[model samples]
Target: MSNSVEYQQSGSVAVITLNDLPVNSLGLDLRTRLLELFRSAVADSSVTSILITGTGRMFCAGADISEFDNGKALTSPLIPEVFNEIDACPKPVVAGVNGAALGGGLELALACDYRYAHPDAKLGLPEVNLGIIPGAGGTQRLPRVTNLKVAMDVILTGKPIKAGKAERLGIVDRIATGSDFLTGAIEYTRVQTVSKNSSDQIVDFKGNDRSHLEDMLKSLHPVREQSKLACAKALDIACTHNLEDGLKMEWALFKECHESPQSRALQHLFFAQRQATKVPGLEKTTLPRAIKSVAVIGAGLMGGGIAMNFANAGIPVKMLEVKKPALEKGLASIQSVYESAVRKEKMSHSQAEMCNSLISGTLDYQDLADVDLVIEAVFESMDVKRQVFSRLDEVCKPGCILASNTSTLDLNEIAAVTKRPQDVVGLHFFSPAHIMKLLEIVRGKETSNEALATALQVSRLIGKQPVVVGVCYGFVGNRMVAPYSREAFRMVLEGAAPEQVDQVLTEFGMAMGVISMGDMAGIDVGCAAAEANADEWKGDPSYQALQFKLKELGRLGQKTGHGVYIYQGREKINDPETITLSVELAEKHNIERREIGQDEIRKRCMYALINEGARVLEEGIANRSSDIDLIYTNGYGFPSWRGGPMQYADEIGLARVVAGLNHYRESLGEYGELWFKPAPLLERLAKEGKSFKDFQP
Candidate 1:
């Protein structure tokens, strides 16, 4: 028997404990051992009942995804085969779910005659998140034990439910209240009557109204449509087919989805997110500095949102502004956000009040002296940032971490102004910082491991995905976006309408088009970022000319009700003036306007981003190719299903990407020749018939 599974006999009950450390994943070895143990218990006349439990916490997480790509996942005694054996066992089997029983784990429990779980245990079949449906008996057995609606919702949404909810839904027989979950399960099994398998039961969905489900299916965004289709198909099979046929149908569909490009991309992203947490050269033993109280330097929108993060995390936060009125306004903004949540019933009034109470406002920097962490969320200006950091250096106590929420500024330069460069880091939170999940943690040249570790810890405490990156102009995300946005603007100069550009990107699965994103982010904001990096855009005359023109005309964006398109409340309508301006700019630059195809528009914008990402990878600004993908997916609204720009490029084939770049370089003349030159890394990989995945940092 495999060491991962331990078998012991207690009276007439055979207790089998799964001992896989760190979440018991049901790999082939564990499945084989479990099957052997079940067969042994059945063969033993003394053992009339079998109790299955896990050592430590986790009953099981799911199939060993790390072995999915290899053939190990399909090895002998597969999960379903073991589950079938358990169901066929003459002796009664009870599953004691002490922790998370997700995906195949839930299927294991379903195969048992009865299941009991710890009060805090979670159970669900979340295979849809990996772009695949459950392959085991989850699709059929879940509907058998629970109603069709409940089963469909659980499997389709891929969300875990608590033990209490699971018991209420009849998915679990009971919630084990005692500290000894195994003992509770064993005791309950002793009194329970032997029953037919769950598969013998059938769910009646013929009279059920499925309009709400259909509406939910239709409401899914385009990027998630493929996964939704897989889910819908699985649910249909579960409702119509018998247990054996339904499991077979689900397995076929699961394989189809597992082999799809979307599945590969989503799976890549899943692993990439985990990889992003690891920083190279940082010792595992390096501990983070303790962060108790936090201080925000500015009381503006960004400042207030930053403060709300700490407040939500149960950490005390102090908001500082230059004046009392500004401080009061900032505090109001924070309160209004929490109040809206309460009004929407997302939180209770007491919870909102408690969160607000954790945040206090001040007008003086001296009050921040004792705070463990100080984050400067002022304007995106170097001089302003330097001044704030200088004051923080004097006022903040020793070992205090100083962070700047500068999205694109040079962290090394900002750290240069302070005596403790090791203490300075960049925590670039996305807009509406309280809601967005991505937090780019910029590590400066002189940054200490302890500081970086602390920033990563704080990011998690505030519910953010922290991607540690090297310091550079625009960092990893914005630097690549610079070329992408440049191509979008240049496409307009070549006679592509703003709506045309946006439509192509949105159709390709981006959350929004470049034009709409520009309007939402504010054209003036782009102009300011450009002006801050004026040296980088010095030679390009046509760079962001339309945005600069719009800024000059005071057509900032949605804030001013005019940008690339006119805004009527939340609706954006095309404006002839913007089109005329683009034509005028083309004529001023002595460029001929020509009709651009949607394919060309998409290729230009996406390739520009991909090529720049290669440059970022070559420069070591990003640690790995997948790190770039994580930033684009989480921070830049890039489609998670397509993976990030780097992964997308790998899917498109590096040789093909290079061919497209070279075609644009020769065809579009000077501007194309300048911008479409593939990065050396991309060129080398293309020449060698390789991919971004082949490049190791």
Candidate 2:
């Protein structure tokens, strides 16, 4: 046997221990060696039963997903064949689930005659998370071993269940109570009688099975609609066919889902997210500074949310404000948020109390003197930021890091106000910071590697995906979104209704259309952001003119129920007044009104984002194309199925993207020349017939 697997016989039990460290994923070499050992154990007359367990916390993570791209996944003695061999063995095979048994890992457990899992082990078929269903008899066997509801819940939701819950659901035969899991499994395997395999169990598919399947489908809330629908269809086939035929049918459906555009896009993001954690130019040996305590400035929604992230990470945090009333109000707001979470069962009361206890409010900068990190979440004005940073520079400790949560301002300028510019960095968190996953760590010209590394480390501690980006307006996400928002506003002025524009974007897989997003985010906020960069819009008087008009009329979005749309409760009703306002603004700006098609709206907005992303790369604002993809997918609500705008551009081919930009430049006339001018990098790549995937850092 290979080193990946350790084979030995304990009494009558042939102990086959998986020695692969880390996740112990089913790679080609590991799979081949495990099968060889299993067949040897079956052929030996001295071995009575087999006990299979892993070396570490993970019994198995799953099949090595990277192997699929390298063609090793299709090599001889595939994962299914190994499972089939175990199922056919004369000696009973017992699985000892030491930890997480996810995807193919859970499927392996099902092939055994009996399963004994550690109490802390987590088991589930989470293949749908990668845009594919369980192809290794999981769909057919899970329903046979457990009830249909449990199977549907496991496969559809793709969330793990603890061993206690798995035993309750009949997914696990028993939970091991001892400290040494392998010893307990060995003793249990020696005493157990031969049991029926999951594949040989009988299931009833009687009385309106289709209706039952539909009802099960309705209860599931998978991330991807394609995965949800496909898994449901696969389950229906599994119920209708025998074990041998059902495995074939399930494999076919799994292949269909694996080869889909949605699968490809999701897989790309899965890898890209891991890649984003690695800093390009930073040295591998650089160590991150310790962040023991944190302080957050400002006491508004953003400030309270930012503080909660540290508190949740088990780090004590202080919220600072200039006045007592603001400090009291902010602390009260934070308590209310924690209370709401407990009320909704999002977090247990004890967990909420513990996290809430770690947070306190203060009215002085001196209280932040001992803090390891200070993040200013004040207003967007540069003058206010400079004043705050200057004060923090004086009050903070010698090595304490000072960070600004400015979404669009220049980080280098913010760093300049501080005497310790090397310790200054940008930790831009999205609104409702405790919930949003994306955190853009902006690196200034003078920012030290230790500061950047600390930001990245702290981001992981707070469960946020950190993307290291260079100093620029809006960094990566907001900078590229500027053009996307511009196109949405311009289309409304040219004749598309706000609802029509929003509908096109949502249909194209944006979580929310740009128009609805602007309103949801507050129209006044948009106007303020545009005004912050007023010098850039000097030549175009019509730029964001409609939103400016809306702000003047006090129609500041959902808060007022009358920004660009009339909001009756949660319903978005079209407002004739908004249309009238657009017409007036269009004529005042001397812009022509014409009917716009759905395809045009999508192309103009998407291409604008893609073009700007290219410019961001050329300017070295973002580290890599994949980094931009991760920021957009995680932060901006760009559909993961379409990947990021850069990946989407690659999918359609860069030549087509450049061609579309040039076509618009000639058609939209002056507006096209101003906004649709292709980035030089994009144009050059198109000329060379290369894609963003080919562009190195």
Judged by lDDT, which candidate is best?
Answer: 2
* lDDT computed for candidate 2: 0.88
Alpha-carbon RMSD, each predicted model = 1.6, 2.1
Candidate 2's residue-wise lDDT over 1-697, tens digit each?
A: 3699889999999998887889989988888999999989989999989988898899988898887662334887888889877877778899989999999999899888888999999999988778888988888888888766677779888999999999998899989988877889999999976857655676545456557787766775444577767788778776777788888888888888877777777788888988887887788789999999999999899999999999999999999999999999999999999999999999999999999999998888999999999999999899999999999999999999999999999988988888899999999999888899999999999999999899999998999999999887788888887789999999999999988999999888899999899998899989988887788678788999999999999999998988999899999999998889899999998889999999999999999999999999989898789899999998989998878899899889999999999999999888888878899999999999998878875
Q: Write the per-residue lDDT of candidate 1 for residues 1-697, one digit (tens) a residue.
A: 3699999988888889888888889987888888888889889998878888887778899898876672334688778888877877777888989888999889999999888899988999888888778888888788788777888889888999999999999999888888777778888777655855756788656455355556565776534567767777677777777777887887888788877778878889999989998899888799999999999999998899899999999999999999999999889989999999999999899999999999998888899999999999998889999999999998999999999999898898899988999999999989889988899999999999999999989998999998999988889988887888989988898899999999999988899998889999999998887787788677678889999999999999999999989999998999999999999999998779999999999999999999999999999999999999999999899988888888899888999999999999999888777779999999999999999989986
* Residue pairs in clash, model 1: none
Query: What's the CA error at residue 238 for candidate 2, in Å?
Result: 2.4
